[model samples]
Structures are given as structure tokens and as C-alpha cells.
Target: MSSHYGQFCPVAKAMELLDERWTLLVVRELMMGSRHFNALRRGVPRMSPALLSKRLQTLVRAGVVERWDDGNRVTYQLTEAGKELEPIVEALGRWGTRWIPELGDEDLDPHLLLWGMHRNVDLEAVPDGRTVIRFLFPDVPAPSRRWWLVISADGVDICDEDPGFPERVGVEGSLRTLIRIWRGDLDWAAALRSGTLTLDGTAQAQRALPRWLKLSPLAGTPRPYAAAG
Candidate 1:
């Protein structure tokens, strides 16, 4: 494989190392700072454990990741070279946010939606010293209606509700609208302007909400791969 890629170019060699179907996604999940096997599985819900393990091994062999055994447990992290791929991963995320088709109701998984939002949110814009934000999912079914989002300094968090925080942002909308906003299909500003999203927090927190949720590419442009399976 390396010889086949050697004939092409450096870019091709890089792609040869990273372009396997689930390899880039595995890198993306690690970029979000998830270090555990189950966390990486949650980040890419559809990936099979066998496939993820294979991709991780491939990455390790390619020197793009380093595996560690901390006494009794194992964890995976990006090597320095792998960390350099952050910009490339972010660019792909920006492209996907702009071009992926809107998911149908049956296709809406709140965890996946939140993961997508987690990828796009500006971590620096989050209020300093605050480690968590509550997401009130009024539209989510009973027993899991509220999400206590915990953000580390890195802006990544475990999406499962944390029992320790107060509700911060009260978003009132259907699951569909929530999906739209999370997927970058709906503009947070326009949603606020239209009274579709109601935010309640301190003035600074309220001000930070829209900026934190702002989308880069304006919405409504049709995705070229709308029908991609």
C-alpha cells in the first residue's frame, strides 16, 4: 500500500494513510478528545466495534496515533502528526455541516445531533470558568427531556445529562427544529428573530448562546450528495 501511494505524491500518501472509510472519522472522534473505546463508539454510532478496532490499529501502525496503557486501562490519543490534522478535520466538518441533507424524523438521534453541534461550537466563546451548560430538550421524549451538557476547557463534553447543574438554555421547539439547528440547517439568529427559539439566562450567557450556535455557511443551499446512503 505504501509503495502504491509512493508513486503518486505526498498528498496521496497522506490520503492513503487516512482515507480508509472509518479512519478519518476515528481521527475526528479522537480530535474531540474522547479517549475511551465506548466514547469513540458513541461519537460514531454506526461504526462497528470490529471496524473501529481495525481502523485504530491501522492508524497506530501508520504512526498517526499512539496507544497507551495507564496501569490497568488502555486509551488512544493522536500523535503530534495526527494532531496537525485538526484543521483538515474541521474543514471537512464545515463542509458536511453545509452539505449534508436534513435528516428525517425517524433518523433523528439526539446524541448524534448533539455530537454534530459539539463539533461546530466555538469553545473560546463559551463563558470562561464555566464548565457546563444545560440543554433543555423540551421536545425529547419523557425521562430524557433535559440534557446537562458538561464542557471542559476544550469545549468537548459528555452529552449525558449531569445531575449537578441548573437548566440554562430553555429551547422551545419540536425535535425537527432542534435537529435543523443542530445540523446547521437553521440559523440561531433567525430562529430567535422568528420566536422559534427562546433562550433564558444571564445577559452575557444569552448573548453567548447565538454566537456559540452560529453556523458558518448560510443555509438553504441544496446538498449535492443529498441522496448519499
Candidate 2:
């Protein structure tokens, strides 16, 4: 059966392509500068690699993505048509933030949270030289419970296993609390005051944590209920 709407309406035609599961998300990852397949995988951690590859091929066929082969490494990038979807994607995000703020337990993923946080790190605000930040989500099980972000002049690298760095800052909190903070459902000061989150390490490290780690851009979108307050 064909997925086409068999109509001339532009919206229907677009939905025939974009409405496929994980399709726009692939586009979202591309828009966020994930050029490599592995990087895109991080953005959609729950997606199977085979499914991801299938979506990429679909987008490439639609002329929204371009796959580049430099012999040694292959990378996927958004074509000009894909780039045009940036504002549309961002608008959908903002609308979702404003109107649909509820997140189910299944919606929370520690790996994804770290991926977004690591990507948006404010390198300028973080201290120079090697800075390792450890994240502990005790509520999560096993290997996924612990994580580290090693930042340096070289950039940020996330590790599920200990990087064995001697000096490190610590962030410990329930997964939900941290996700809330990241999504702007809860603020840092409020979480700290309520004892939902904690930061450890040098006083400087504690002070710099919020400054250097940027939250989701949609995190600040004004909600209707918030505006009334």
C-alpha cells in the first residue's frame, strides 16, 4: 500500500514524507549538527541502528538529506531543502513546550539528557584545562546510572564508564528531577532548595555548573499558565 495521500495539497504531500515515524527526528538531529551516524544515534538513543539507517536513506531519497562519502568516513548532512525546515522544527518544539509540558517515565532517558547537555556546553563559561563532571542517577540501573563529561580545550566527550580522572565535579539527582531542570519545568535554585538536586566538588565548580551547562533552547518558551502568574 502506498503512503501517499494521492492529493495535490502541499500539506498532505509533505506529511506523506515527514509524518513517517522518526523521520523528522532524523531531520532534527541533522539540524543540530550531528554529521556522523554515531552522533545521530546519540540524539535518538532508543532508535535501532537499522531503523535509523532506513530513515536516513528515506530522507536522502526525498532530497532533504545528503550523504557524503569521503572514502574513509561517511557523513550525512541536511541539504538546502532540509535546512529550510529548521524554523518549522523549532516552532513545533516551542509549541510542544508551551502546550504539552507533561513527560511520562518512558520519555526520560539519561543518555539523551547527557547528549543534549554535552552538545550545548558553554565552553567559554567552563574553566580552562581539563574539567571532568560526573553525573550520578542512582534511580537508574547499572551502567546507565553513572556518566562523565570530560571537557577540555579539545571539547566535550561523554563516558558511561569512569574516565579515571582524579579531579571531577559531581552532580547527583533523581533522573526525573534532572530532566525537569533541563526542560525548565523546575529551576535550579528551586531544586537545590527543595533538595531534589545537588552539586559537589570545588566551590568554583559548584558555582560554574549552571553557567556552563546550557539547557534546551525550548526550555525557556513561555507557557500559558506561566504567563498568568
Candidate 3:
């Protein structure tokens, strides 16, 4: 109400609630199947805990989110009204992919990239037993440069520190290059051929790695440049 534009337009009324910073991002996380509070934080890592809590409370008040407290753990889920925004969020992703093809240096986040990749692990495509893949971003600073993805029948887990498991594969590349590959802005084979990306592991692991970790949801969005070509 306080952020309202005082207009009777439906769009204006919707913007009154949805235009707040981090509001739709919270919804986006929910749409992506992040149910717990900490899991939501991982989706928007840069947002402060206090701000996230506030936003969650606001969403609860708006009836867009339902908070369940079973006394043991509290989980957040989108109400029917909130679930309706999925198409909007997806459309925004596709629009950005096609129009905003270039990324600024500040937009490249290794943490977020790794988190997304972890979520996109194709369980059926990966090996039957536990498989560990280490990703090295040499361009990043220490403590943040190395990451590991441990995948199994249970699920996928990402670790910044060494998980102490024997790594099945190692991928070394610049952060930008890897992000570009994940976003479909660049090709995996092209990056490898240009030496921008390298895989050091068993022949089979290297061959199946790309299939094992499916790229971003919007990666397949056709770009304008490519369409013109």
C-alpha cells in the first residue's frame, strides 16, 4: 500500500507489490523448488539474511507464500497465486537471454553459477555410483576459486572446500568462459579448442561431463544475433 502508485491500473497495482527489490527473486527461488529458508538464501546469496526474512514475511502477508512450521522445521511454499507467476519469470529469463547477450564483469558470479549447475545435474545421465567433479576457476581469488560437485542417487551436493572424496573429473577454466558455456553464449567444444576451457580426467568422464550437468534452464533460448545469422 505504501509503495502504491495511486493509479487504478491493474499493472500499477501489481507493481505496487511485485516491484520491490528481491521480491520476485524470492518468488523465482520458490518456483525453482527451493523450499527451506537456507535453500532460498543460496539462490540469492548476496541478499542479507535480515532483508530476506523481511521479504518472506511480506510475501506471507500478501498471501503469495505459505509458511509452514511443523515445530521441527519451517518451510516456505508458493500459494496458487504465486505459482501463476512462473511463466512471467520464465519469459523474463528468455527475454534477457535474447536481448541482453553481454554480461558485465560484476554480473559474473562463480558461487551462483555453481549453485545453478548443482541444481541442474541430470541424475539419470550421471554415473550410478558417487561421482565427484572438481571445477577450478583460476581467475577467481583463493577460497572461492575451487568448487566440487558430488553426485549420486541421493542428490547433488556442492562444496567449496575439498569434500575428501576421490575426484572423478577436474575441469579448469576461467569463470567467464564457464559461465558463457553454461548460458549457451559459447560452445563447450569451441572453448576447449581455444584453450579457454580444459578437462583433465578419464576419457569417459570428460566425454559424459557435459551431458551429466545440463546447462541453465534458459540456455536454449535463441539469441537475436543467432537468429539473424
Candidate 4:
């Protein structure tokens, strides 16, 4: 089969560099600030190490990615040109969130959802101390209406029961609304106004919730998307 995407337009050329099965996804994972090879591999669980290495090499060859030796280990990162592809990745995320089928009733994988949401969150904004955020999914599509999420300097913590901590905040809403808020599709103010979501806790903590999870702007690099073979 011929893989000619035309030879003139820059966009087509760029797509030729990317637009592969798992290539774009690798780029997406890197956009979140992963560098080490193992870290990258862990980020995209569906991708194999062999394929990831090949994709990284392809990207490096195209100048969209740079592989560096950091004393004891090697790492990969997007180049100036590669950073420009952030918008494309963001667009792809939005599309996936909107159209991808729900993971369905039996307790949505909190970690995966949190991983997806982590892309938008500002870790620096989270409180310096411990905090618990409970997600109450009224229309959870399951029998339960409660799930617990703890956030701290370490990262997100998921649990079936509240940890009985003093810094707990309750968010009441449907699973869809929770997902929307997490994805940054709906801002806190709007979600509150529409009554799709509600929060209960210290004003400072409540206010910080949105800022902590806001999406970082995609203002770097231009990379090609390639699929893992």
C-alpha cells in the first residue's frame, strides 16, 4: 500500500510524522511532563516497550523529540517544534472524552480517571497538607453513591471509605458531572451555577479545587504522530 500523504503541505508532512496508531498517544503522555523511558512506558500501559522505543526513535529522527543523557539515565522530551503540537493533542483529548464509550457501571477505574484528570490539574496549587475529596455519584449507574478521593503533596488517593480525616471535602453530583469537572469541560463556577455539582468544605480548600485541577495550556512543540507497529 502507498503511504503518500502528498509532498507539499506542511500539515500533511507533519501528519505523516505522526498520525500513527500509538504515536500520537505517546506524544500525549509526554506532554504531561514524563521523561524517563520507564515512566513513559508506565504512562501508556497499552503500549509495549519495544514499540515505544521505536516510536521515540522515529520522533527523535524527525526532530520532534530529543533524547538526552541525564548523567545516569536517558530521557526523551519534545523539541521546540514538537511543543507546537499541544493544541492537536488537546483537541484529540476533547474528542475522546466526548465520544468514547463510558467505562460502564462497575466502579469506574478511579486511577485511570484520575490519570486522565491529572493532565488538567495544577499540582502546585493543591494544599501543602492532607485533604480528602469525596465524590458522591448519585446517578452512579451502580448501587453505591459514595467514593473517596484524597489529595495531598504525594498525589491522588482513592478509597472505598473515607479515611476519617479532618480535611475532607464532599462533592455531590452525577458521575458525568464529576467527569466533566475533572476534564475541565465545565468550570467550578459553572458547575455550581447549573447545580450539576456542589462542594462542601473550607472556602479556601473549595476554591483551590478548581485551580489545582485546571488544564495546563498546550504551548509547546510540533511533533508527528506515528502508530506503534
TM-score of each: 0.64, 0.96, 0.96, 0.59
Give the true-structure RMSD of model 3. Answer: 1.7
**Model 2 C-alpha lDDT per residue in residues 175-213, reported as the tens digit of each score:** 999888888878888888888789888988887789888
Which ranges in model 4 have alpha carbons more than 4 Å from their true place? 6-9, 41-45, 48-50, 71-73, 87-112, 119-126, 134-167, 172-174, 187-208, 215-229
Extract clashing residue pairs from model 1: none
Model 2: lDDT equals 0.88
lDDT of 3 by residue, 52-155 (tens): 99999989999999999857889999999999889999998899999988888898888899989999999998889999999999999897999999998889
In terms of TM-score, the best-performing candidate is: 3
Clashes in candidate 1: how many? 0
| Candidate 1 lDDT, 1-229, residue by residue in tens | 2235655678987877777787888998898778988889988898899989988888888888999996777899999989999889887776775565656667767677666666666777765655455666676786656665565575566456565755455455556666676555666667778766677767677777766654433244455654221
lDDT score, residue 49, model 4? Answer: 90
Work out candidate 1's RMSD over C-alphas.
5.7
Model 3: lDDT of residue 96: 91
RMSD of each: 5.7, 1.9, 1.7, 8.2
Native-referenced Cα lDDT, model 3: 0.91
Worst 10 residues of 1 by lDDT: 220-229
The parts of candidate 2 lying over 4 Å away from their true place are 227-229
